[model samples]
Target chain A: QQQVKQSPQSLIVQKGGIPIINCAYENTAFDYFPWYQQFPGKGPALLIAIRPDVSEKKEGRFTISFNKSAKQFSLHIMDSQPGDSATYFCAAKSAGGTSYGKLTFGQGTILTVHP
Target chain B: GAGVSQSPSNKVTEKGKDVELRCDPISGHTALYWYRQSLGQGLEFLIYFQGNSAPDKSGLPSDRFSAERTGGSVSTLTIQRTQQEDSAVYLCASSFRTGGRDEQFFGPGTRLTVL
Candidate 1:
């Protein structure tokens, strides 16, 4: 079973627009959420992350809005640019477990920004 | 400040052949992980190693898949009797520690194609 589910397998947006990708998980034990960005033929890079303790966290143009009760989190890219075009992935990790540090990833979202 | 590095960025082999992929983590990192990313699929966890602890291999798809970390810095994932379904991008990542909050640095994945 997929532990984390993501929606909108592909997204297209004009430059300067905002692109939002959402993810949901059923495991309430997950406390750490992170987003990764990957370019073609490259590995995913850590974009931003958030802890369930806070409702939201923003870094530069990337923002993570997390709802602990709903077991959901979303990534919003403000002033999206053409360079932001890449595959985005949402992942979660349990704080305590034999599987600690093992991240469960969601289906990736391919975001394309048109100039 | 070197990042995680993977070898043989791309590999092509026939079915029933065995293949080995390697990863070199950043200096001094104590945690290493292997993940598989299939086309249009999420990053699937395969194995994890932290310090001298026993590796968590529960995520490995089958006995044909195995990995070893030597000297706590380099890792090699070996696949025996590969099949077409084994075709995917194998990714490696490393972190400073197994802490829930530590960011993972990923290497450019090794794309394996089984024909």
Candidate 2:
């Protein structure tokens, strides 16, 4: 079973617009949510992350809006740039359990920022 | 400091051939993980390794796929009698600990193609 599900398998956004990617999780045990950005021929880099305790987290132009009750979280990139074009993945992890460090990833979303 | 590094950046082989992918985690990181990314797909968890502990291999697709981490720093993923469906980018990541809360540093992945 896919523990986490991501929507909009592909996204096209104009430059300077907000590109939002959403993710939902089925397991309540998951307490951490993280977003990664991957460019072609490169490794996925950590963009931003949030814990269940926080409703939202902002790191510069990247913001993570997390809804604990809904078991959903999203990544919002403001002033999107063409340099931001890449695949995005939303992942969840369960801590305080034996399955720690083993992340459950959602299907990736391919983001294209059109200049 | 160097991030995670993977070897054999690209491998091409015929069906039924065996292939091994390698990963070298960052210095002093206690947690390591393996994931796969197929064409136009999201990251899929394969296994995880923590210092001196047994790895979590629940995400492995089948018995033909196996991984090993030695000295808590390096890992190898071996696919035996590979099939075309097994073709994908194999990624490795490392974290501070076994818990999923820590940020994971990822390597540029090894692309394996079974012809």
Candidate 3:
């Protein structure tokens, strides 16, 4: 399937807490997974990405944990802040065919971080 | 700015009308994609263009939705007989290439309201 399922339609967290968003895909052809962040009145932006080859990838306060065997992956914010409150999306992409690399995004998770 | 840009930041149209949204991708980028974002939902892939090859229109939701990229640069997405379901933010993204391509930069989406 081209669908990427995501969990927790919405989340609320306090400052310094960790907010986690999970995603799973059934298509084995998908090799690239990326996370995007969207704020009000703006477009989604590339936050971080990971390849199945690695189990984890970290950039700044964001980290991606991948479980290829289970066809699942997740994003963890090390220290959540009010500014980090936004809609987070998980997307999967395949190299050939299958929409020609167009990303298949999950139902986004709206995260709210209380200061 | 040097980033991807979109026109008609906000568009309100009556049902059964046709609306056109334009996008200007960054220079030197060869791939462009169109997506629809309904309220509180993930982005739905619509179409993508790669170089001189024919665009991948498989993601288009229906025959009323069409897109055109002229001179391999600017793109326009046209939605005919707009329905309330078509009320959403239309986003445009551009990447350096396709197939394991580089990061896609997104523009401030056009908020399309079909009344």
Candidate 4:
């Protein structure tokens, strides 16, 4: 079973627009959520992250809105630029267990920003 | 500071052949992880190593897949009898600690193609 589920396998937006990617998870033990960005032929890079303690966290143009009760989180890119075109992935990690700190990733979202 | 790195950025091999992929973690990082990303799919966890503890290999797909971390810094993932379905990008990551709050630094993955 896929632990984290992401929607909209592909997304296209004009420059300066906002692109939102959402993810949902069923495991309540997940205490950390993070987003990663990857370009062609490269590994995914950390984009942004959030903890269940806060409802939202923003870094530069990236924002992570997390709803603990809903078991959902979304990534919003403000003033999206053409350079933001890449694959985005959402991941979760549990605090403890045999799988402690091992990330469970969601299906990736390929985002394209047209200039 | 140097980040995680994987060697043989791309590999092509025939079925039934054996292949080995390597990862060098950032200096002093205590946690290492391996993941596989199939085309247009989410990352599937493969294995994890933390300190001197036995690795968590539960995510390994089959008996043919095995990984080892030597001296707590370098890792090698070996696949015996490669199959076409094994084609994917194998990513490696390292974290400063095993806590859920620590950010993982990823390496440029090794793309393996089994023909």
Candidate 5:
């Protein structure tokens, strides 16, 4: 019940194109969802996040769409540039748990934005 | 810089050798997390520390993995009798848990290669 499955292990899109990555989870206790972007030779950085109470949250060109009933979420990139190319990971974490709020990540999707 | 930093950016070790990865979390941050990312795989939560104490270690894959934090500051992850499967990027993150929604800041990561 701790797994977060992500789709499209690899995604390729042209510049200015929108790429959407989807993820699903089995644990219903997860209240917070976050998307992380990792570049070559660097650690993943927080791109954007959303809470289950809301359906969608946007930061700059990144958007997180959450579906509470379906136990799924997605990350959409608006006008994706080549600079946005990287491995994207979707993670979920519950509020209060023995896990100490450790994030459960998906398999990851390698996003390549072509110029 | 004030961001999280890791030492020995790259490491190449022979099989059966033990390796230790270090992490310096953001100053004054109370929470620290360790994650491992294999090639083309998503980040795996290894362990997390709350004020130098790890509450849950279920994420650790085997008995060969161990980690510790001191002074609520620096943390180290040690892999004993490393195998080919132990080769991966070890990333560290720190967060100030406010009991609400918190953001984790990640370090560049230490790449470990077992030959």
Candidate 6:
């Protein structure tokens, strides 16, 4: 079963636009959600993260809007630039039981910010 | 101080051969993980290690795929009887602790090609 599902296998946005990537999870036990960005030939890097308690969290131009009831979360990149073009992955984890810290990743989305 | 380091950025081997990929995590990080990314596929979890405990090998795709962490610092992924289907980028990541809740630091990854 696909525990996590992501949409828009690929995306393209003009510079300075807002690009949104959506992810949904099926397991209610998951509590932590994180977004990662990866460039070609590089490892995925932490971009932003959110917990269930908050509806939205923001850092700089990156924001994570989480919906607990919907079991969905989305990453928003404001002022998207050419440098923001890369692959994005969303992961979930449930730290409540022995399965704590085992991340279930969503199918990645490739973002292309046209300059 | 340096980020995670992986050896042999790229490798190519013939079918039925064996291959080994190495990963050196950040110093003092106790949790290590291995994942594989095939062409056009999402990151597939392979294995994980925490402290001295036996690894969680649930994600391993087959019996021919195996990984080990030595002294809780470095890890090696072994592919026996390499096949064309085994060609993919193997990624290694580390965190401050296990349970995948902590932010993971990923290496550049080793690209493997089996012909």
The residue-level lDDT of candidate 6 at A21 comes to: 94
DockQ of each: 0.91, 0.82, 0.85, 0.90, 0.73, 0.67
Lowest summed lDDT across 10 adjacent residues in model 4 chain B is found at B96-105
Candidate 3 lDDT tens digits, A4-61? 9998899999999999999999888888999999999999999999999999999999
How do the residues A38-97 of candidate 4 rate in per-residue lDDT, one tens digit apiece? Answer: 999888999999999999999999999999999999999999999999999999999987
Model 5 agreement with the true structure over A1-115: per-residue lDDT tens digits: 4489999999999999999999999887788898999889888998898999999998899999888999999999999999999999999888876434788899999999999
Write down the worst ten-residue block by lDDT for model 2 chain B. B96-105
Off by over 4 Å in 5: B52-54
Candidate 2 lDDT for residue A34: 88
Ranking by DockQ: 1, 4, 3, 2, 5, 6
Q: Name model 3 segments beyond 4 Å from true.
A: none
**What's the best-to-worst order under lDDT?**
1, 4, 3, 2, 6, 5
Q: Residues B1-115, candidate 1, lDDT per residue (tens digit)?
A: 7899999899999999999999999999999999999999989999999999999898999999999999988999999999999999999999999776899999999999999
User: lDDT by residue for model 1 over A1-115, one digit each (tens)?
Assistant: 8889998899999999999999999887888899999999999999999999999999999999999888999999999999999999999998787447899999999999999
Report the candidate with higher TM-score, 3 versus 6: 3
Q: Residue A110 CA error for candidate 4 (Å)? A: 0.4
For each candidate, the alpha-carbon lDDT, in order, equals 0.94, 0.91, 0.93, 0.94, 0.89, 0.90
Q: What TM value does model 6 have?
A: 0.97
TM-score of 4: 0.98
TM-score of 1: 0.98
Query: Hey, what RMSD does candidate 4 come out at?
Result: 0.8
Candidate 3: clashing pairs of residues: none
Q: Alpha-carbon error at B31 in model 5, in Å?
A: 0.5
Off by over 4 Å in 4: none
Docking class of 5: medium
